[model samples]
Target: MKMSNLAVDICGVKLKNPIIAASGTFGFGEAFTSYMDISRIGAITVTGITLEPRLGNPPPRIAETPSGILNSVGLQNPGINYFLDAELPELRKYDTAIIVNINGNTIDEYCSLARILDSHPIDLIELNISCPNVKEGGLAFGAHPDTVYEVTKAVKANTKKPLIVKLTPNTSDIRETAKAAVEAGCDGLSLINTLLGMAIDIKKRRPILANITGGLSGPAIKPIALRMVWEVAQVVDVPIVGMGGIMDGTDAVEFLLAGATGIGVGTANLVDPTACVDILDELKDYMIENKIEDIRDLIGALRI
Candidate 1:
């Protein structure tokens, strides 16, 4: 691996780069191992896991839109027990950091999952309060400030590992949601989860997704994600992980400028399996071109 000024320390966890494969997009970090070197990227957030195995939403779960895509996969996973028994061992083979994204329908469920992962080999536990695909507990818990605080506090109490609260864009005030999570004791924050969106098949006169509505991801939400990250960064003292429509190094750089300690690649992974590695290379090139000695110098460097 060619060395560069891309190393970063997010909440005491060191990353070779700032680019991570966002949750829900990267399935346990196995699918892309053949296409590219997984260790080259900063980190990988596995698919969201629940207390029990989920069959997920019905078919036609994805629809492509202008500059983005909408998905309502519904947090399909083989449950945490299966993950710890089967997936975690295989994922640990890679040299990259493994951060698991966990989802639940209740505060107790969230705490349970956190406690289970606390003693495991995973490097971090990302709370998925922002996922919009589920009917309950996912976005429902994240939409309100009080519920966000309660759930975050509950999970933080159960886990010794670093906790990162993923924030939803559907809420009335993302700042309030971020503040609540921070106050509740999250060590870090990631924003923004896909925006609520829908697509209709005009020929059939119905919605394209079986769930009626899905979360919008990709380039379309970058501006909103950057704005929210900037807003939360101003109010919170913990590190921020910025994501949404980040397709290239420049987009990742934009997030860092807006005050993100790290960046995540989501829909871009669906477009090209090697997107994360490619973006990291480009980031290094940018830093070299700018004569920047350290990537950390770019974090929160955006000037009004």
Candidate 2:
């Protein structure tokens, strides 16, 4: 099948395929250059950027689990100036769409970052309201629908680029948050960031991660991610980028069937450097085998 068969659109941005390199995993699209052709990705959501640089959490920040990993990396990244001065220029040369994920400790900080990025050459702005590992701004603004609306509306007012709000799975009802974000003016939404969880070291009699608690990711959260995406899709007409434990083509297909316009490959990248391209190939094979031509045909095509 041709590559065009896998093309997808998120908001107004056109992706060559539905495979998006999720934030925190793809590392600004440059670190993976030696692993695979970064241009093959549909879009790249760079690491979470903040108004100021963050030292992140202490060591022992990542712990392996049965089918997943718990992480408390704490949104470690250079400040926005460094990203704009050092990273954005190099990323502009790539063929894929560029989605910058921005986070802040307050609504003003979020607006400031969006305002600064408005003049630059980016395809989209992903308002990272759902980072569970952080202490201040991320999950705090995401957990409540009212706060989600306030922050999303504030950020949307400050930028011209399409805003895609990434939602947290820790919320009581993700659909409420999704509705609030859309009502607040977000152009699109990304669901099921990471589930709140932790693990304990029996031998040491202590928590595995230094933070004691962390965000759970990988295959363990796929089912929950799909359910949230499906539930949110039923309530909103905007595009949805579904992520969490998307390790293979079959997993990507599941998200699409559940109503994700874009598929986010997170932990799979850590498991395989070429996972994005590998999954893209596998998805194409599945399409051809099923006699499906256009990739859009699979979006929201789940059979009840």
Candidate 3:
């Protein structure tokens, strides 16, 4: 067995590699055990969990677009307590970093969730500020810098665990949100979440998703995600976890050059359950072929 030394220190969590399973894709980490070597993954970020279990939206929760997927899952989850009691216990059996991705409807909700998980034996906590801001009457917090900082600061007050604020790409200025999160004491950043989009059934003249509008994810959003990663990298000092429509080793490398310390595999996992592990393997090959000894050497290596 050969080790390629692709380790990364993300918000104090030292991962064996730089490839992570994007939130809301890999389930609770146990789901990937049947298809791939789960331990090879740098981390497996669970699906977005709220305070309570949610059945999610109604039928037609997903719409297949030209080159991507539109999802209005309504932040469905098994709930935080279920995760802490059952899922977390199962994940502790493995050595891979277990990242808990959380969402809330209000600032106090964010704070409560953070405080609840503060004592858990988890490696990191990722704040999904992209969730609907109930105080704003359903506007997503990540769409505005003020709400972004508010949620981040609220959560920071409750937990000592590393907090990584995940940002959405629908904002007017992604850099402003990144700066806001960093100033609020976020240990890291992850972007970009799904872009706001809607698909309409021309025959019926109605929206495809149950919620009418859904977040667009996959290859179609890759260009936009990469651009945000580059822009946010210049303004924020924290490590960035970049993902949008990454499916292969090449996409991972592109993110690294864009100044991301790590890359998340989202829609790609649905395409191939072993996506993250395979990406890490391909990354190792790329490093050896390029005469690079460490993966960190490739981060921000891009030049004009």
Runs in model 3 deviating more than 4 A are: 1-3, 132-139
Model 2 quality (TM-score): 0.98
The C-alpha stretches of model 2 lying farther than 4 A from their native spots are 1-4
Q: Give the alpha-carbon lDDT of every model.
A: 0.93, 0.94, 0.87
> In model 1, which runs have C-alpha deviations exceeding 4 angstroms?
1-3
Model 2, 1-304: lDDT tens per residue?
A: 4543788889999999999999999888887899899999999999999999989999799999989999999999999999999999999898999999999999999999999999999999999999988889999999999999999999999999999999999889999999999999999999879899989989999999998999999999899999999999999999999999999999999999999999999999999999999999999889988989898999999999
Q: What is candidate 1's lDDT per residue for 25-142, written digit by digit as tens?
A: 9999889999999989888999999989999999899999999999999999999999999999998998898889999988899999999998899999999998889988889999
Q: For residue 128, what is the lDDT in candidate 1?
A: 95
Q: Residue 230 in model 1: shift from native, Å?
A: 1.1
Steric clashes per prediction: 1, 0, 0
TM-score of each: 0.98, 0.98, 0.96
Q: Which candidate is the best by lDDT?
A: 2
Better by TM-score, candidate 3 or 1? 1
Candidate 1 vs candidate 3: the lDDT winner is 1
- lDDT (Cα, 0-100) at 17 in candidate 1: 85
